[model samples]
Target: MTTTPGDKFSYKIELHIHLDGAIRSETILDISKTKGRPIISVDDDGQETVITDQESLDKEIVITTPCSLKLFLHAFNVFMPIIAGDRDAVFRIAYEFCEDCAKSGIRYVEARYNPHLLANTLDKPAYARERGDFSPRDVVITVCDALDKGSRDFNITVNSILCCMTHQPDWSAEIVSLCKEFKDRGVVAIDSAGQDFEPGKDPLLCGHKKAFKEAYDNGIHRTVHAGENGPSEGVREALDHMYAERIGHGYHVTDDPELYSRCKEDGVHFEICPLSSIITGACPEDIMKHPLIRFADEGVNFSLNTDDPIILNNALADDYVLANKMGLSDEQIINSIFNAARASFATEEQKKKMLQDLVNVYGEH
Candidate 1:
């Protein structure tokens, strides 16, 4: 049976979703119109297509089939130019994420994004065309303010994680600082985003490494995107070098028997995005042979997630549907929910409350 929102479950926990990747198409269109920014994107053939409505915008952002990670990332280039550097757009997206989570019965979520990607402070901004007064620090502040308000207004707990892109290790120190500064305002952790190192290639122990160490020293939680498109060695590097408390899309960890055993023994949480794994070519096409099934069968600590709903054209429910299709029993599915709650970076008191709420919904784990 498919676990749709508000169907089988009354409450849920999601740990791996990108805030920028989940923006509503209608919101993007509305913001573009309001700012007088043209909604245009270049197609595979190099022809520019003018997006005039929600349908066209969705066509640009949503991935309908399996694709390489590189192609999947290109979806961001389609609309981020309109959303990034805009204060209202940034706030609205963060706030609306809460509303969407509530609708999906997600009671607690740790939404992550790169503040630098959203800011227009640098001479060469990540997405924005022109430099502006808004800095990465301002992006964190805006997201915190919006998430705080959204959590209160929507009656769901929401927290943010600052991401450090692999290409821009220079931003890692500032990201960790922002995490510390906004700890009271709902920023919970530091994350490594963007591309991962290829197999046999050593993870760059540069500024990113230093920042992660600082976060570890200061009590900040850490997660890394490893072994999704990269090899299992990347997962080893993340754990050994970056001190990752959680592994994001760590499917390829299974490729290393020793590493996989270590992770399972250590209870390292894997944020498994089922639909995303398929569509992003991070795993095999057959659901029956998916790593999530192996994780479930082996009793690995893992949580299902909709990694990028807007891009994947899915919801939390869609992820559950895929898990069900993979023949995961309801017991396993519910266990994944509990796994997410236990692995979350929330405070001990907060985790206690969240675990109690999960038991209330799912009935004694």
Candidate 2:
């Protein structure tokens, strides 16, 4: 079991937590029962099987073995019942996410998820035909407000990255417009994630480069989930075609010497989530031989994150312990923390404060 990091590393940062995937287990149960939704689970065979009861609900929440990405995604079915277009549930989850991060000593975190997924519930006949004043834009507003509230109420900083799923419609322009509308609020970046392999999505994304251009032209940072489930070429496409500023789980950059060198030259940071990689079958080996050491050794700029804390039953402190488990030294972990701060989307002032706090805690590592 991974324990929390020791006292030397006092300040923590989370750059890649998914909002829905990180929802509290208690909240999941409450939403499932309250909404009369079926408690669901995906067995090792990647089949959609019911959770049966509370014991299964508890078990399915965390994965102990390598699982299919398709099956892993099915686990999200439980949350769709709650987060799909319900403003109260949206605000509550957003608030609780930041609050929980604060309690974990995460001073600054970037919460990410496909806004389109959250909008799935809103698109239903009941929400559209019955409610006249509502639109998807309002969902964006509510979530941003909740993040702001979480920052205020919990005294921790929270920010969001809107996602554009490659397989789905490219609402990239609409998402960009929403980010611009609330840029002064908590919304910060735009991301390309999900179903990266299929050719249908790639051409669709290629055709919608205007949306990416819109975000880039409007000054929103871009990140893409590449090299996780797909080959390293996805990482190349993310950088060359999509104008990505950073690459999520770009571990496969190492698969190609040129790509690794290109990212190195560009200073594109990798958002590495060790436990998520292991749980989702992205990494065939456990933490010990994970690409973290290789990436660090090769001078690849990267940051450790709790991609889905609730999903993997992992924590940011546990991430530090994980680094140790990977046989990384305390000095390397400290250096990586500073590296993450440098690569973060946080403002310079926030980054300065973070480093200042780090200095006070670890004292010139």
Candidate 3:
């Protein structure tokens, strides 16, 4: 499909996606049944209702509700058991995520997950017997292999990042090592994800400095989650201290002009997930009122992404449509795509190829 200069261009690169957050609902049900966990239910109205042995609630518990930051983090905890067990399960999730991306017209993407969380949940009984020395490095490797195979199989490109949860200091070194191990196998970068639960806890406390230093020293790229649930200081810390090349959900940066200016000057990209931000209460209710357009207008480079497409009921197209609704012109939308391509961890040659592909596809009449 040829795109006109004035027409909407679907440039396909997703920089801020979460792996577990992208699992299909049917897959969730299948995994729940296979793992013998509590069955999730749906009402006549077609709303999901998950009942646990520990608690009971009648209404559908939407993960995208605008609540406190803690509640937003709790949303993903429900899916841990469903996604963490078998290699095939992870493979299937990766496959389905890619399928969804294809349907959304996303040509390339970087999906992030903390393999430590997946490993801890999957290897508990086995590791208990082995005195806890067993690493889920194999599982991480398997997931990467699945991603590689899926990319070739589906004719859609996808990359992954071993997200080191900022709350877990003990596993930082191991996660960094995993990134190094998978450096050549399409593991493009490292991420700091999950909730910043404690106010006293520093955003850099998860040994991100050490992890980023190690990854940078080893010639790996870094992207850190900051300013979503914390202050602008957290964003600054990620850039200045942890050496993040990209900041995920940096909505709070609107409050700090100096930090915003620095990011623009340094060419650090921000992966802004609009629907996810609305669902997680990162922004005010309206999309037009979002600070994303302001940032874009100010020349703060960023890419539109579906942070948790499944949970937010969003897709790449949704992000683009919302961008238009937020008063961004076609050229501005194209600029966002270019920002994503520029921030992508793909090699310079690969990036050039992708950019050329985009220009050829969309630049044509």
Candidate 4:
């Protein structure tokens, strides 16, 4: 196919990837064995008996959804214990994550994770001594340092965002403070992640209002996990309550034309993760039927991403390819790429430079 001037392929950016869920499967297994943790079984018979439903599972093992969220969360349980007490483990994970993104041809990527979850893994003795030392602040710092080092080492640029689990809104104050503390260290935004189906466990509960206010007040960028497992209300809450500049998995907005129009008008970028959505049962069985295309047709500002690459077994290119196969035209693909670049938390100057780079690579005027 003779590509048009505007069809020339160029820059790609993934703004909604999850850090912990992006860890390599083999790497998780290695960490699990090293920590003497029993591996969750997924045998040939498919009789793997991990927690399929959060309601049915023991409280100790937090399983959220049977389809997608359950699997994603279970995957985390396998690795969290292994990497918790060790600083080097956290560093290695961040390093490897960047390496994976670079290998996948992601020039600039923003990976988000809940630092509190990782902080809960501090060395038992160290944590015990302090009694009140349950903090992932150091892990956040070390991981950022490792990411920066890896970025320099691998010739790829990666930024980290500390995600707040919305189930715990009180932690927002601390997370926002951490974002400010590490603003210069590559911690750019705050995110709320986890199963979105729980009643009253909304982004607002996670200090979305306060966090966004703080981020704006501090001149930091803001993003939120919205519209994944809930209705249009969740999407509206993310915008009205949190003032999120970018939305993670805002797929449900498709159900509400008004909100979709609002998103389009306000230029709130939706970080759509195809594989994750499919695997999590958030999307229909067919990729072509995904509402993202409809939203794209409506000119909603959005971009493709791999929310949990490891769990979904996907990458940035995979998403692009999927979109293409699902009938996205070359122009739409290029536009989505530009949308991502523009929606990125990078500064205006950076966005301009990236857009120019895209035009140069794709020959798009």
TM-scores, each model vs. reference: 0.97, 0.89, 0.86, 0.84
Stretches > 4 Å off in candidate 4: 1-10, 34-68, 121-134, 197-206
Model 3: residues with Cα > 4 Å off, grouped in runs: 1-9, 40-61, 121-135, 197-206
**Position 34, candidate 4: lDDT:** 66
Q: Which of 3 and 4 is ahead in lDDT?
A: 3
Q: Candidate 3's C-alpha lDDT?
A: 0.74
| lDDT scores of the candidates, listed in order | 0.89, 0.74, 0.74, 0.71
lDDT of 1 by residue, 1-365 (tens): 12265457667899999999888878889988989988889978999988989888887788878999889989998889998898888999999999999888899999999999999998899998789998999999899889999999999999888999888878888999999998888889999988776534545547788999999999999999999988999899899988999999999999999999999999999999999889989988888889899999999999999988889778887788779889998889999999999999988888999999888778887
Clashing pairs in 3: none
Residue pairs in collision within model 1: none
By TM-score: ranked, best first: 1, 2, 3, 4
Q: What lDDT is reached at residue 230 by model 1? A: 88
lDDT of model 4, residue 202:
37
Kindly give the stretch of ten consecutive residues in candidate 1 with the minimal lDDT sum: 1-10
- Give the best candidate by lDDT: 1
lDDT of 3 at 208: 64
lDDT of 4 by residue, 132-167 (tens): 343678778878888998899888778878887766
lDDT (tens digit, per residue) of candidate 2 on 139-202: 7787888998899999888888888766655466677787788777767888877655542355
Candidate 3's residue-wise lDDT over 177-264, tens digit each?
A: 9888888888888888887423336654746678888888888899888888678888888877777889999898888998888888
